[model samples]
Target chain A: MNEIPQIELTGITRVYGKGEIAVRALDGIDLTVAAGEFIAIMGPSGSGKSTAMNVIGCLDSPTSGHYRFNGVEVGRLSQDQRALLRRHYLGFVFQGYNLLPRASALHNVELPLIYKGLGRAERHNAAHEALRKVGLDNRAHHDPSELSGGQQQRVAIARALVGSPQVMLADEPTGNLDTKRSIEIMEVLQDLNRSDGLTIVMVTHEEDMAEYAQRRIWMVDGRIERDERTRKAA
Target chain B: MLWETFRLAIQAIFRNAMRSFLTVLGIVIGVAAVISMVTVGQGSTQQVTADVEKLGTNVVMVLPGQDTMQGGPGGTADPMFTLRINDAVEDQIASVALSAPISQSRARVIFGNENRRTDIVGTDNRYFEAARWDLNRGRFFELSELQSGKAVCVIGETVRESLFGFADPVGETVRIKTLSCEVVGLLKSKGASTFGSDQDDFVILPIKTFHRRIAGNTDVSTLFVSVRDGASIERTMEEITALMRDLRRIGRGEEDDFEVVDMEQFATMLSGITDILTGLLSAVAAVSLLVGGIGIMNIMLVSVTERTREIGIRLAIGAQARQVLLQFLVEAIVLSLIGGLIGIALGLALAVLGANWLSIPFTPDPGIIMLAFGFSALVGVVFGFFPARRAARLDPIEALRHE
Candidate 1:
């Protein structure tokens, strides 16, 4: 495709501390992802895969580099401007399923829309549609504690999709799930990517989970060691 | 957005209801103490003012002692000096409307078979005029009767009830100590004074009759001097002080042996003392408010720490730092406002109960209630700022990584 990539990074570096004890989490690197692509990033514990995801999600700034989200340089933007960008275009899912424990599944799905300043009726309708897309419409009233691990992950996916973001960044989406639950989450994410043409960047160590993506990028020691295509682009 | 923040805050506060209530308990106690103390103090001051008004503000009491508060010259002066002071005030001072020498003692009075111990006052007819007392029936003492030192007396309502039991005692003969005195008049009823002493429990007789028969000595304890209406009490007091000093042979640079106590000044002094006490107590109570604010700050800090992950989640979900700060701040304000409302109710309740117990008027000041409410809100803002800012300034990555 000749269209401009949705995300572009050039020479990104992230250092954690000061001179002597400083740890460089991500060394100089460059990568780009086009619209509607499903990509998975994989590495061992200290390989800086999570830091790369954080930079892509606008949750952390690079030490010295350019991060272009939709071709707009994100590194130069203020903290509030970046937050607005995140609100309007990006969604994230964490390993812990980070849904507010006290809130119901529907409310968790409605969280992003609330930050988007949507009206109550619009938020409810959109949240319901997102939940139905994740095959969790019947479990909308249940709290996170009441839902199974796979169900909770589905609710989080619904929350990410409710904002109608251009990209979804999921860190260890199936890290806490059993084999069956992991497959269930991976199938829901695959179906979303193929049917809705949603772009996703997932960080995971599981090879089976990475197979759900069309392309896989492997990180090692703060740099990308390999990038390979497992399937043709949808 | 603000409404959403408020709703979130309320939900968080309700999540740990017991802890929230305990956090605001200090504010409740502090506000309650301040409000109740001031309310009761105001009520007492009002009562004192009303009592002094009843005694007639123009009346000045001349006692046979120096200013008692200063621990100055103690004990009564010479008995003849009191009479001389009264006579000098009556004859020399043009501002003096009426001056009467009064000698008092407690004595038992008997009528038929009923006898009771009551106060006996010895004075002339000018005493009734100076005291603004009225005769309910019969008449006051004639000039000849006072001059001849006749054993004629006027009975107060309390004595009349004790001795005659609602019977007309105007012409009844009652024995006072060892002398048999005829009741020439009946005094009207005057209720309890400021000190809760019964004002209608005394019998009045001529000073001469009291000096010759009951006391066996011409000793006048005090002089009641009433200033003329529209005359300056300060000027009249200065003149009386000058005349009394001249008559008592007290020289310059020496304190007078007698004290001229203006009823108005006494009332003012009483109210001033209560006001000072109330202010001191309120200051102490306000310290507790400061402590309450600190308590709120401590709890807010703890809450921020405990909710670190939640803040991270909110931040990651595109919530602005200002929005997170606003959430915590609203929670603190709502908590303290709840405490303030409870304190107001408790304080007003205590004030009413205290007023009834102390027999003072219940006076709840609306201005104080408003001040307390506004102060609590201010406390919430001031103390909640640090914790809220800390929460806002948190690094989302580090916060999310927190266990």
Candidate 2:
């Protein structure tokens, strides 16, 4: 499909602190992603992969950049406007599987829908569907503490997908899981991408985990050192 | 949205029920103290007002000295300074409705085998009208009996109860000292006064009979003067003062030897004093409320810190800063409101118990309860703000990295 890119970043430069003590997290980066591509960013510590994800998720603004989302200039938007963008178009799954510890799996999934202002019954159904997609519908009533690490990450993914965002930004979604649980999570993400054609941008240092993505970008010292398409879609 | 936020807040508060309760304990004690103190204070003030009303606001007592509230005569015990029955005989004053001379002495009365020490008052029937006392049964002393200085008396309900029990005391003769006095009437029951003294515990005798038989002299220690309903009490008091000064032949600049005490003014002063006491105590209790607010602030700060990761999760999931603020603010308010409700219940219970113990009426002021509730909610808002703001302003990236 020939459509406007889902994300575009031009001359993105993110600098922390100021003057003599300045540190640039992302130095003059330019990139674009189509509507249905799955991309992975791999880097070591201080390589700025997380910072790039933050910028893409609209959780943090870049120091100097032009960021466009679905052809709209996002860099000039206010903080609240960015939040609304995140609420409507971006879903985040952190490495810690940040489901509310006290909330049931169903309620945790319902969190994004609550911000989306969905009605109770409608949110409930959507959350159940999302949980079913992640193959954790049976664990909906269980709290995060009662669930396994894989189960908790699935719940977090269900929460992200409940809003049906335009893009999912998962920062090391399987970082805390064992290799077996990590492969299981990768399979879920791969199945969603294959069947639903969902756009995704994931960050991971594990090479095998990054191999699940259709395209891979390796970063070093705030610059992209390698970019390659490993394989075609299934 | 608001309902959902409240639900979330309630859930979070219930998650740590013990901590929430302990955090609100200060508010509970402060509110309870303020409510009970004000309630008990109001009850006593009302009792005092009722007691003074029974004395008849239109009535003014002319005592033979100054500062009689402390006790008897403040100056010299000169015979010339004492009130006489003749002083009450003057009907020349325009504001005077009724005037009766009263002289009282504590004496033991005996009827059959029963004998109890009680106050013996010497006054005519006009004292009943001036002092608002009504007879429960039998007749007052007739004019002929009063003129002849007959040894007749009217017994109070307490005296009748003590001396005659269930039998009628009228037509019976009660011995006071060596004098046998006929009981002509019985005063009605007035229950307990504001000071917890029995009002129906004195015996009344005709002043002439009292002077000739029991007192053995003509001396009236106090005078009860009732002013006309339409007359100003202050003006009447001034007139009485001038009359007494003229009667005593006092110089213009000299203070009158006698004090004219307005029953209404005394009642007002008593109530004023109680009001100040209630306010002072409530202010002290309010200090505790401030301390309670500080307690809430401290706890909320800790909660915010403890929930940093949770807040990060919420923000990452696209929760607005305002939404997070509202959640924490609602949690604090719910905690405070719970404390307020419990405090109200505890305070009312204490007020009821205090009233029963002190023998005063129990009066629950609804306005004060509403004020307490509103104040607690206000405390929640004021104290909950900073911590809530701190939570809202947190950077999601940094917060997520927090342990």
Candidate 3:
């Protein structure tokens, strides 16, 4: 099979500050992501998971690394290039839900497509399709503040999915939800991975939450501690 | 894309409408004050020129005893001494149109029911044309009356007004010192001089009458000479110089004891001083625009700080660094442009009001209006740079993290 990994990171290291005060946020990390793999990163706080997410999301630069995304070299890309990557190839859902409080859920979902230069009607259709996938089509016109926590998260997920990105990175996608809502969100993520063939990378501290992914990677002190794969249910 | 950015800029301004208006008020008032002050200064100059032209076009004024004047380089004050001779000036001058001997004194006058103060001028009929005057009610004194030293006088309009109000003082007798003279004619109106001196508060009589009845002497204080029509003033001035030297009985190398003035050159000389005043006023007013520019800079800086999050959102949503910079810069430019437009309106309105107050014509220069507006836009660009650069250089990640 000649299909290469959709994303790859090799010997990646990030340094901050200078001399004695300097610290490494990521150390000698290597990883590969298949086109449709659903992977979870489990780590304690400040284990560089969020920092790695920033690098993977193209919002930041890694101090030292050879990072490849979708078979293209990404480490040397310019700011504009990374913005293009974020626009065309990657989607993001952060723990804060990050939906603008004043914007309606429909506007929030259409925002990514708007930046992609889609027409208004096309953007509306895509946003509605994504919102329907997340089971929040009825909440599309509600502001983030007017919606419940689970609904807001679904709107955020819809925003991520609206662009039809190759990868969706969810950082603690269910961190702010109760047990029932958390399962519902995980079910949505699982359905996307199973039915849509979208590569999913989730960051979580909960073992039960990470167990839902096909593969798990553990991190500590800015370094990878373990890698494990869960067996398919018989 | 530019249209979208423009819409966003306008929207941002309207989002805090009152704050934006208050911020631009400094620029508005500053520009308006600048326009009004300059227009007022120019209006006064134009009014003065019109009034001076009424005296006589291309006329030159000469004065006697230059050594008797005391002031700074450009200071204007009354000369301390008077010319003592007029005989030489009467004969030697060439291309002469009219020449009149004049002497003056401050006098107290008494009429039928009024007492007033006036300048007592002793001159001939030639003084009328030289000074651009016409009789208001009767003919000028007859040549027989002029040569015979008759005790007759012509009063200026202001003198008539002060002594008679709406009544006709002509054909009536008034007393100056001990002489009782009939007002044979009244002079037409001549408004105030640039220095606010009353050009109409004067009495005109033949030089012969003034010398015999008032001064008890043959000496004349000054000579008012009018050159031939279309004659080069310099030629007549040279002739007057030779005439004065001969009439005063001075030797070839000795300076005559009198002076002659060309009214045209005198008007230019006076205008030169006012031009300097106008230039200085404009310079001081220009500083207000500069201060207005600084006000824009301060407000833009505050705006950049206030809109940090919005900038981050824009950048994240695909705005280039230059795009962010352009957005802020255009916001400032739009603000200053609006200010300039409003300032022009307010300034022109004030200029019209000022014209009425000063009793002059209302005129607004289109060039000055364009200049004021252009200056405001230039201020926006020059002063808004730092704030725009600050916004463009902000880290999007840090901005996203910022509240």
Model 3 residue runs over 4 Å out of place are A4-6, A33-42, A88-218, A224-234, B14-41, B44-52, B66-92, B100-125, B133-192, B198-222, B281-295, B339-369
Stretches > 4 Å off in candidate 2: A231-234, B67-75, B80-90, B108-117, B135-186, B191-196, B208-214, B246-255
Per-residue lDDT of A156 in model 1 = 93
- For candidate 1, the C-alpha RMSD (Å) to the true structure equals 4.4
Docking class of 3: acceptable
Highest TM-score, which number?
Answer: 2
Task: Tell me how far the alpha carbon of residue A109 in candidate 1 is from the true structure, in angstroms, after superposition.
Answer: 3.0
- Highest-lDDT candidate: 1
Off by over 4 Å in 1: A232-234, B67-77, B80-92, B107-218, B242-257
Q: Output the number of the DockQ-best candidate.
A: 2
lDDT of 1 at A228: 90
User: Per-residue lDDT of B234-307 in model 3, one digit per residue for the tens?
Assistant: 88787777765665467967765556666666666777776787678667767877887788899899988877
* Preferred candidate (TM-score higher): 1 or 2: 2
lDDT of 1 by residue, A1-234 (tens): 777789999999999999999998998868899998899999999999999999999999899999988888997777787788888898888999988898999999998888888988999999999999989999999999999999999999999999999899999999999999999999988888888888999999999999999899999988989989975343
Query: After best superposition, candidate 1 residue A136: deviation in angstroms?
Result: 3.7
Across B64-181, the per-residue lDDT of candidate 1 in tens digits comes to: 7643334546744343445666787899999999899999889999999999899889999999988878999999999999999999999889888888997999888999888999
